[model samples]
Target: MKKLYSHSSFFIFCMLALLLFQSCYKLRGHYGGEQSFEATQRPVQPTDVALPKGYKMEAVATGLTYPTGVTFDDAGNVYVVEAGYSYGEIWTTPRLLKIEPNGQTTQVAAGEKNGPWLGVAYHDGAFFVAEGGTIEGGRILRITPDGEMTRLVENLPSFGDHHTNGPAVGNDGYIYFGQGTATNSGVVGPDNYDYGWLSRKPEFHDIPCEDIVLAGQNFESDNPLTPDSKDKATTGAFLPFGQASQAGQIIKGRIPCSGAVFRIPATGGEMELVAWGFRNPFGLAFSPEGRLFVTDNAYDTRGSRPGYGNGDWLWAVNSGTWYGWPDYSGGDALNTDDYQTNKEDPKFILAKHPAKPPRPVATLGVHSSSNGFSFSSSPAFGYEGQAFIAQFGDMAPEVGRIYGPVGYKVVRVDVKTGVITDFAVNKGKTNGPASQIGGGGIERPIDTEFDPSGQALYVVDFGIMPMTEKGPAPRQATGVLWKITSEGGN
Candidate 1:
């Protein structure tokens, strides 16, 4: 996912000014390390990472290019998606590499010259993949056992930081996936210029009249705003996720082709919306009890539509419920600072939703850039029924100065209590100052999966994305497929 904040050099300067005046910043629980740029210091190999007692880590496959998602076949062969040649530019040639148990590897399928493949899953003799969109829109592609590929869902709205991700198979035998929006929020404004054509697509802005709201100086719409008084140009429409409006009608067809979870039968059928209102829902997993869970990337407080003061979230998904995007963060009203320039702006007032919004089960750190996660169910691994999330870490001067080193390790979330604990770390407690956490520790752990036997986990370490200005700092051919298992087989 491309972050608008990192691209904004001007914002970095402003944040630097703020940092100079501040001293003795108290440590917050959300921060993973000190608020300083860490130089990429060490080579991150399997042996260099730290693990818990009786647990061992080893590199199973090396030399991958920005690998994002991983899965395992019934026979124990590992399949990994290499988000090929990403300079944050969406180009295909992304390959689905199969790493056998014996260490042999081969490309099972390669994406066309388009965008990268962000997610993959193995089910019922086929590999389901989430192909991101740039030249084209995102789609769900299936590679059969013989390597033939077919599209299941095509042309979803994807042209910004977040792409369509995850196609996890649900208990009901449906394949579920998440489609992200074009802009950070509803209207793509001047703050999101780096996205070029994405922020200017008129078709994407089409929404129902009843869903419009008076935002900023006027009712901003994806469609070009007409010059008029705020009171008349946009009368009053429910702000979709419950922003104060003159008209309290709950409407649909808002924010075209974005921020929705969809499901389709394994045999293939029309994709239907399961839920909506996620900023960037990247990871999807199902618990042993068949409940759906998602690891969502929270808002960044930079760019034209920056959201305020809420972290990424882990949600227990329920069908047909809205999870609050543009209007709210983590089920609470989004901070007024996000949209309004003046604190006293009446637009900051809240509105009652036609339906109540759902809250996250657990809150994660802001800009942690969480991606894929899986349920740890095997008792042998000692975290039965917990979700292990791969935090890709933050990569911006603004985030590093404020939130510190947010995410770069695998975190375990207790399903029952929503309590989160660090299950695996690169170097305990001292994750930031940037230099101390890289090279040897997990630089950017992107995805986690359980082995077929459920005795170990396969972690995809997306090598060397430091939380600094010149970040997205890739350690070429440094991506590794790691195996986390108990020492001496427990």
Candidate 2:
């Protein structure tokens, strides 16, 4: 016999249906947006691809910290760098480790908090590491195979949100690294309007304000000097202003940072600028043909007005070229309107000035945060000359206060044809369900590298984000290392 449901029970059923419908709508909207593109399907369990047939994958290691960079030595030993928690703040652990083929791990170097160490490369029998800093900025550490370490370079401008990271050994034998700007979009003063010491308001007089102290201004602001005025500007000589007055221009820049790629001689010398105007280049690599390529994180517009989906990019880098940061992203040309308000336009006399034409080989998902990448030189991987890139998930919710999460897996790209296909999936029951969560998964894999045999690939999993009122402690173990190998077949 059929029974009538209670009023409360019927209401609850209706509410659940409405919630499910709303969720589907949101997912559809997200995938149907301008950033939508064809992505490779992921498998629930690790699956192998058809690679001529005999090659296989084996888990060499597991349970690692936030491993961001990996490389191999001539002796077949593997080296990995771990940035333990603290990240951008003043309390992260920076470590360099060596992993043997037998799964043995050894710590080579360690630093204090906020030391976001990333990017390691083996060259000329020595290992170089990129140590990211906050107040003191980033530095390149040189280490011998015997575990001896020394600071090769220091005092990089890392106070900005994005610091210097990612070091690569170029075919030219020079060590290249990236140094990011301190401010977002080149604001000349504090972002806030509060009259407190941290505000970005201009000074009442022209007596060398905040901008002069932190980042010196090449010229005076709107106010000028008169022969006999109460607050006259000093000519030729610079003078200090009150601490409160100086706060306005502390974060200013003559021309907002285009971001830069620099090279230091293998034998040690001053770092020379290679390319400029990149937003945050997290990955750099040279193809088998010796061409330079860079992976850049796109700009976020949620904090500012009239936001645009500038889009992340994969650029074929050339010396003296500009990739357009703070002004442009993707392949769009730079325009006057893109500049930050209240700032002067950069001088455009140089040949590379006014933004050089950019031609990206591939367009990563918007806000995907693509990091380390390596060319699949091993024929065992099946795709000879193909490139593998790691997506560090998205961080918009933490920084930009927006949500545009699409990529959470490794992508294989055909550099010549601009074609991208999903290469590997990090899905499992331990992470979350297989069902789509707003068209994306939750595993935040940050870096990828092929094993010495080239039959298997290693990926670093930087666990879940901490949600408690008090975040995870410094050096907390919340990271994992996963190995992906071919199970066999097309």
Candidate 3:
């Protein structure tokens, strides 16, 4: 086994080198898009990855292209979705696949240009998905087992840095999802160029679910829509490029708003707003007690607003409550030096608080990309009712600088006390990805789920997506799907 592992590693190394050489020769040093690399895949050594005793891990599927979420149907048939798009604007046909127990996979459905399909949930014999919709507007779709698809909602405001995400079905028979803001803070600016959407949809900006009175704060930056290299313009929250809102200006809010949570009938109908004021509410799951919990990505130290020194927030959501965005973090006001980065001092964009924002249950790492998660309900898995979140790790320099490697593992968070502890991480003296630490246990675990019986946990690994000065360089066919079954863990 050892000899076989070494031989496989050597082969991957050679292949990567050749691919890099070819890309450089063809692109003449362009780093974004037009370049494809393979993620180095070694055998999944259960012992090499640190997990609780009595729990064993196995790589059930490999060579997936940017997989985002994993789920299982009523009959215990496992399914996973390929995002079809990555941070660097690498777009392909998004797909849903069924994985057999032995790891063989078959395509179930294919999506259109509206991609980076963030997630899928199986409820009532149909698969519901949230399309990122970078090229077109975001949409919610339901797919039958035979591959017929229908649009439940369309023209959702997703032509921004973030897009439509989630569809976590609830006990109330509703499908809930998140719509992310177009800009980092409230204002859209040049920093959004990294997302590869601002240039395509210059008029696209965030829309509030309820009318908001602006503070009249306008951000000035190079207008991306204009051909002039230095044509500057001022932008404000809820307005397009070169548009500004005056003090106390009421921007009319509407349903299907950006930076909010929305729910629709399982059978498809009018979209209803659940809550608003999240910057990028990425992951949504329900606790055993029937409460919706969300993992929201914190404001980055980029963009025109550029707030600093705050980690991600995990909240037990309250219906119709405004969890502060563009103004607060972890229940603290952003209009203070605590959030001021070297480049910008953040200020509240709204004239008044919608209401005192509820504090997050727990805080995850900065730029950790604390995405898709699930609750462990099985008595055998331990930590029953606790969340198992996949920390996709940080995109440093591009997102911001980190003290050390922040999150590249799975963690369990206690809902009551807001305490977090490592459940699964790469085995190393120092924590990092396998590519950085010469290990192959795990890389960028994007989502987590348990089987219908709750006896096994499945993890989706969206493979190597390295950040460069140019932007994110996401590789293809480098993802992995892992399953962890427990005999009994206490």
Candidate with maximal lDDT = 3
Instruction: List where candidate 1 sits over 4 angstroms from the true fold.
Output: 1-42, 85-87, 90-92, 102-104, 196-256, 335-354, 398-403, 432-438, 466-475, 488-490
Off by over 4 Å in 3: 1-43
Question: What is each predicted model's overall lDDT from 0 to 1?
Answer: 0.67, 0.56, 0.85
Tens-digit lDDT track for model 2 on 1-490? 1235577778899999888766643432322122211222332223322122443434455555566788788886777887743431324456777886676688877766546787888889898887776535577888887778877778765544466777888888899887664434433222111112112122211111112332222322222222343542321112222222222233323321226777787668777778777767778877778887888877644321112445568888888776655445565544444532334332121112344457788988766778778777766566767778888654433333323245567787889998988676433422221223322232556777776687767766554432112222212343546666665553
Off by over 4 Å in 2: 1-58, 85-90, 101-104, 188-258, 304-306, 333-353, 399-404, 427-442, 466-475, 487-490
* Each candidate: RMSD: 9.2, 11.0, 9.3
Per-residue CA lDDT of model 3 for 1-490, tens digit only, reads 9999999999999999988666534322222343445454545555668998788898989889899998889999999999988887778889999998788889999998889799999999999999988888888999999999999988988888888898799998999999898888888788876677777888888888888899998888887677999899988887887898799999888887878888999998888888888989899999999999999999988888898888998988888999998789989999898888886669889997888898999999888889999999988777899999999988776676555666889999999999999988989887866665657778788899998998899999888766655676777777889998887645
The candidate, 2 or 3, that scores higher on lDDT is 3
**Candidates sorted by TM-score, descending order?**
3, 1, 2
Q: In angstroms, give how far residue 47 of model 3 lies from its true place.
A: 3.0
> How far is 1's C-alpha from truth in model 3 (Å)?
61
